[model samples]
Target chain A: MIEVNYKHKLNNFLLDISFTMPDKGITVLFGPSGSGKTSVLNLMSGLGNDKNKKINSRFIINDRVIDDSINRIKIQPWFRNIAYVFQDHRLFPHMTTKQNILFGYNRCNSELRPEVLIEKFKIKELLEHYPEQLSGGQKQRVSMVRALLSQPELLILDEPLASLDYTSRQELLPYIECIHKELDIPIIYVSHDIKEVLRLADYILIMDKGKIVDQGDIADLCISQPLLTQQEGASFILEARVTKIIEEDKLVQLDCGETILITAESMRLNDKIRVLIHARDVSLCLSPPQDSSILNCVPICVDEIQADENGKLRVIAKIGKQTIVSLISHRSARQLNIKKGKQMYAQFKATAMIK
Target chain B: MIELSPILVTLKLATITTLILLLIGTPLAWWLSNTSSKSKVVIESIVALPLVLPPTVLGFYLLLALSPDGFIGHFWLYISNTPLSFSFSGLVIGSVLYSMPFVVQPLQASFEMVGKPLQQAANTLGANSFDTFKNIVLPLSKRGFLVAITLGFAHTVGEFGVVLMIGGNIPEVTQVLSIIIYDHVEVLEYTQAHYYSIGLLVFSFIVLFVTYSFNRKLMVRL
Candidate 1:
């Protein structure tokens, strides 16, 4: 477990934040630019050392005190064993790719095998090349490997893919996901991109104006923080696994405990994924629809009915353990007599996003 | 033809001065590049004073400081039983201070050019400050080192005013190439003066050319 508490006056705002993360998972620090997201990362990693700026911080990772302002027990970044991947891939310009990766591996006395990461990140052929010779995405990959080989107790990635093009971001996402899957190293990924949060976050911390406004499981935060939706309104996420692939129809079937189908590509059998569903796309029916153009009509029970600020109504419903939301008119809510514990079916097209 | 001892003495003084300057200048330049303290400007101004100050003015103060009765000279005389003024050692001290900016400025600029990002990256990868400096900062600043060395060495070799003021023109000791050429011209020996003058001009050019060409070929990062 890693616990962080920081209070420092930045040029724009007062950065007061306190948060704890699990022993191992991707804990995202999501916020807009200048919201002190990077500042928090800097404090935790011992990178925010400006003698002019006063900071009172305490960071404890697994019962070990990494820093404490009151005690004056400040550790330097090198000895702290916290690795950071910057937005720009900060590979040493003078070193070859092999030397860059081995730099940390050698200095940290890391027991992790370098050959495995080099092969996994697919930089074997690029070993002899300098950072200038590689493409943007390739440089980032090498940087990730370099950070991982250091065997950090915590890995902080400050928008590692922000500088890449759309295709390069897509290409690099899996490599990041691979790190989460293969290693038990606790990672704090910072980003303002909604898609990245939905795809990569295991837990979410929504920061606003240097404060964590909301935080919880990604599925819960998705429904609560409208910013996580990437759309204009309320949204929810459905945890599902790939069950079947219909190549001829360009469709994929998912087992979200209800076997939902959506169109996507490049998925394997039994691969876990999250399906992002917008409340506006769903229309609630009192009973399962028999004749409709919609393919998904999952049965759900109304969890809550609240009036939206737009004079419409929002019906929060539960499908087994997972929750889905619906946006409908107040007139429709009255006609259906929508109330808590009311059984219904949600009808939405299969055009929902698959992550 | 030009009295070999003066040429030999000049090369020896320049070589020794440059080596000492590098050893002293690297840390000074590194501190100047990385520091954000209030004294940085003050220290920078002091280091740069020699660049604009007349060499004779610097030589004048150096002559006092190196004299047997002066503070630095008093302490040195008590320890080594030797006077700093009119000796090869005194000339070295003058040349080093005179050429301070040539070595330190280029090194500081190169170190600044390497930037803090790379050093931070090295730190996160478990490198202490000195380790990162040795492996990352030094290699990237190859051109800076080359320029500094060439300028330091050449500037020391061409020194005339400070050496003349402090050296007292002792043969086979402090009478360097520039002083020997001055001696020749003073005695109306224009031919001997021209020989040493042309040799110096060609030597300085060759040194600069080789250093720059090598610097370009080395693929320095900054």
Candidate 2:
């Protein structure tokens, strides 16, 4: 686990934050712009320390005290064994892509061969080319390879996809996923995009201004967060595993405490995935509708029903232990006679969420 | 035939002076470009003093400093068995000081252009300051080095007042092209003065033309 507690005076507010990120998955620092998310990453990398002001901070990564103000111990950035992938992909313009990727590998004396990374990132064809000649997605890929070849214990990705277009962002997401699955290195990813958080985050830390307002698993946080549900269209993630593929109907069967059907043909069996379901896309019924077009109709126990300020009834329910929310009208809740501890069925259009 | 001794002496002095300035001014320029210390302004002003000061003012001090009884001349005499006054080495010292800003300013600007982002990236990649400078910064600042060398050599070749004050008109040793031209004009040898003056002008034009053309090619690659 990586634990950090930092308190520094920014121009607008006192940036005070403390949290422990899981050591084996993607822990996303999520917030709006100007919310001090990038500042947290900078502090972890030991990049921007004000010489004039004494910054009080304590950072420990898996029992190593990387920084401790009380003891006056601070490791330099080079020796900290932490690698950073910046948003701008700060590649050396003078070096070829091959040389840029080998920069950290040579310095760290890493045993991880550069050929393995170059092949994995799929930059073999562009090795001889300079950074200026590569596309945005290609540059980001080279940067990731550079960071990984350093053999760092922790990798910090500070909005690595924020600058890319939609197509390039889609292209780079799988490479980031590969880093977590293939390498098993812990990553601290900072982003303001909720869609990215829903797709990539295992643990989420929500920040406002400069303080961490909440932190928990992304699935639980999305369902329980009032600030999240009150937004225009709130969504929650479900941890599900693909059980069977039905190619005739172009659908994949998922086991999320019940047999949930989604219209996705690209997934393979036994693959674990997170399904992002929006509240407005879900509707509750008194009984399981048999003749409807909706493919996913899972039986859930009603947990609670609360009235939002906008006169819409927010229904919270549970499928096994996982929480799911639905935004319906008060008349509909009254018509269905939904209440706490009552059994009900949550129906959602499979095509609305699946591609 | 035109006497080539003064031209040869002038070339030798400019070559040695450019080399010395590069050796000392490179580190100084690098430091001035990167330092945040409050005393940086003081050092910068000192390096820039020769630009605004009258050449005779600088020559007057060198005359006192390089005299046999003066501080530098006495120290030199004690160590090398030779007085600094009127020697070729004395002319070199004066030229180095006179042409310092020309060498240091371009270097400083180029170093600044290379900036901190690339250096920080190198540091994260485990390169220390010196290694980063050698591998990343020096190669990128090629244009700056070219401009500095060209300007330093040309300015040293053109120096007159400082050399006149300290050189004492020694033959083939302290008699550079500019000093020889001055002597020709004094003795009404108009034809001789014209030959040397025109030669210096053409030589300067060719050197500047080649450097600018080469610098343009370097910039395209950068």
Which residue pairs collide in model 2, if any?
Answer: none
**How well does each candidate superpose onto the true structure, as a TM-score?**
0.91, 0.90
Model 2 residue A318 lDDT? 95
Rate residue A124 of model 1 by lDDT: 98
- Pairs of residues at least 3 apart in sequence or in different chains that clash in candidate 1: none
- Candidates' DockQ values? 0.78, 0.56
Q: Model 1 over residues B51-127: C-alpha lDDT tens digits?
A: 78999999999899999988778888999998888999999999999988888888888898898988989999999
Binned by DockQ into CAPRI classes (incorrect, acceptable, medium, high), candidate 1 is: medium
Share of real interface contacts recovered by each model? 0.95, 0.56
Give the lDDT of residue A11 in candidate 1. 84
As for candidate 2, its interface RMSD to one decimal place is 1.3
What digit string (tens of lDDT, one per residue) describes model 2 on residues B25-125?
A: 99999999898889998988888888888888999999999998899999999999998999999999999999998888888888988888788777777
